[model samples]
Target: MNIEHLNVNGMELAVVSSDEIVIIDTQSALDLAMTVKYETNVANIVIDKNIICEDFFILSTGIAGEILQKFINYHVKVAVYGDYSHYTSKPLKDFIYEANHGKDFFFVATRDEAIQKLTETQ
Candidate 1:
């Protein structure tokens, strides 16, 4: 995984890029809150949504929700990019739809779209 810091609204935003999965490994809510507070003007972030481990499946939804809550609490936008066609869970699909409707969260099919969404957020 590679992380690049970009200037957005005069704040540094971390852009994590990886062929496998994108992860934000903030130690705690306070850490994330600090990052968000400092990067308040940052509009969006792109995260890889691919699940690599079987054990992760159980926690993925909660993790996704937690991330979304953080974004919402901070008034930041986010885009999760990956192929979600393999997942046919109704609840998951519904969650995706709900997230897409919000200006803060987007579920994109391609990395290009994710980047576009994150960069274009105003």
Candidate 2:
């Protein structure tokens, strides 16, 4: 869980990069907004997705929504990386689909895809 702070649009974006997973733990809407604002400039955040825990299923979804809402508010784009196949809940799956389809949020299976999606300019 290596975390680093980055400057994006004059806002601090915390970036956590690891061999197992890379999580950008946004402590507030401003943190999320900053991340989305410079999502494209940051690259190769996570090399693998196997480090993500199954327990993060619900928390991750909630965080994604929160981040997306902030991104929408600021008109920015961001990508979330993790595997959703382990989850058996139908509603959670629906939420994931909805977030992925939206411009502000993207749910991906691989780190590469995550970085690509995040970096893509909208």
* Most lDDT-accurate candidate: 1
Judged by TM-score, which candidate is best?
A: 1
Estimated TM-score for each candidate: 0.63, 0.53
User: Which digits, one per residue and each the tens of the lDDT, describe model 2 over residues 24-109?
Assistant: 43344345344533653442232233434343356545664554565566655555566668778877788878877765666788
Candidate 2 has a TM-score of 0.53
lDDT of 1 at 30: 28
Candidate 2 Cα errors over 4 Å, as ranges: 1-26, 32-56, 59-64, 119-121
- Residue 19, model 2, lDDT: 68
Quickly count the clashes in candidate 1: 0
Clashes of 2: 1
Error of 1 at 4 (Å): 2.6
TM-score of 1: 0.63
Please give, for residues 1-122, the per-residue lDDT of candidate 1 as tens digits. 54455665554455445565324332343254355445543445565665222222334547556656766887666676778788767777888788787677788988667767666655
